[model samples]
Target: MISFLRKIRQKLLSQNRVTQYLAYAIGEIFLVVIGILIALQINTWNQQRIENNEELEILLGLKDEFENNLEELNFSITINTKVTEACVQLTQLIRSNSIANDSDLLDDLLVRIGTFNSFDAQTGVSSEIVNSGKLTLLKNDALRTRIINWLTLLIDQEEDILFRSDNYTMNMMPFLMKHFPLANGELTKKLPFDKKKYLQNYQEKSPFKFNIAKEEYLEFENQIWHHKHNNDYVSINELNLKDFLKITLQMIEEELNKKK
Candidate 1:
């Protein structure tokens, strides 16, 4: 192409038709400019295509990560709800004075903890996402924002669990211990700490805190263990715990729904 242009330039200089030469020079200049522009446009197009592909891949990866996260969050919520139910039931049983001795109540309380352990199982959504190194792969800004918000809320819930666990245990446990019986053999697990231990170890800011409400209910939980010490037999408060369990299940549902 350069050779062709050179030949044209040579012709324009030698030809007698100088007006025609000027027109031809202008046309050649326009053609060269257009070619450059075309090349630049093609380069831009290729770059944009690559970027779009990368963005799409990120979106898909983010979708998968969030979906799994959502499921786990929902599961945690289910467990929390069940634990809550245990609290409510234990409260009713204790407040209603349904048990003649504290031993049966203690068993119910222990069982409640067992239920809590099952429901309040440890979860690692943030860890999983962070470890997966997939958050870096997220391309959609909107999706990323949503994920961040969801994670923030989960953190808040965890914080709430930390906040309420201590004092609730301190305030409630000693009160339950007065009625709790012991050495009945009907209850299996022993109440390791007496009521005062709650206040002694009470912490609103402990990094080691479990759900305070969980332990709060556990203070009365020893009542069943007490009854077991005395050879009395009875059912724990399983039915009453269901309402909290139901709440937990709802949380799971809400977490799942968040993905949509």
Candidate 2:
């Protein structure tokens, strides 16, 4: 192609057609420029297609992670509700002078005391995307903003859970162990209890005998207060998780549809 154009230019020059040769040269340059632009456009299209596929994979991974997170949040919410209810019942009994000789109630209350959910969401893929500067590939401005907000809230939730866990493990449990006997403390640290045997024998074999004292009841009241405080935080985080998960899932669906 270059040789043919050069020959044409030489022939035009030999004929001394200066005006015609200049016009022909300009047209040839324009065609070359157009070809380069077309090649560049094709390259840009291919690169965009690769990026789109990668974004879809990231979005699908996020969907799976958040779905699992939703399940965990639901479970935590249920446990928090149960713990809150148990704390309320115990507090009411103490306030009403109805706690005397309520060994059965005490046993039940103890069982519900430290059953906290300490779950962490799977954010490996999301974190990698954000930290590696791939977040811009999301394309949708709204979705990007939502994802950032969700990650921020997740950090907040994790901090709250840590605070609650510290309260339960360091303050609450130590107080309980000091005052009352727990038969299954060792068993609980490892795995699920052998339910039938545990329920039947826990009270009898407990190191500290059943004793209802004013000081013990007061300590339990303090424990209940801490539990209630943590319960409220759990409820707040559960709602946050639900809302974030719902919005992200919708955005993911939209992106998937666009991909198809």
Q: lDDT for each of the candidates? A: 0.47, 0.78
**Candidate 1 structure quality by residue, lDDT tens digits, 1-260:** 88988888888788777998889889989998999999999999998777656545544444454455445445544544544655556656656554445544545454444333211322354345446675544444444455455555445444444433433355434453343332222234323323354323222321321222444445555543333222111112222223323443344344435445
Candidate 2 differs from the real structure by a C-alpha RMSD in angstroms, to one decimal, of 3.4
Q: With candidate 1 superimposed using the best TM-score fit, by how many Å does residue 136's alpha carbon deviate from the native? A: 12
Q: What tens digits encode model 2's per-residue C-alpha lDDT throughout 1-260?
A: 89999999999999999999999999999999999999999999999999998899889888888888888777777777777887888788777776556755665677676666665777888788889888999988898888788789888888888888888888887777776565544333321233355433332445555555776777778887887788679777887788878888888888889888
Model 1 residue-pair collision total: 32
Model 1 — which ten-residue stretch has the worst lDDT? 229-238
In model 2, the runs with Cα more than 4 Å from the true position are 184-204
Given candidate 1, what's the lDDT at residue 255? 40
Report the lDDT of model 2 for residue 67: 85
In model 2, the Cα lDDT at residue 114 comes to 67
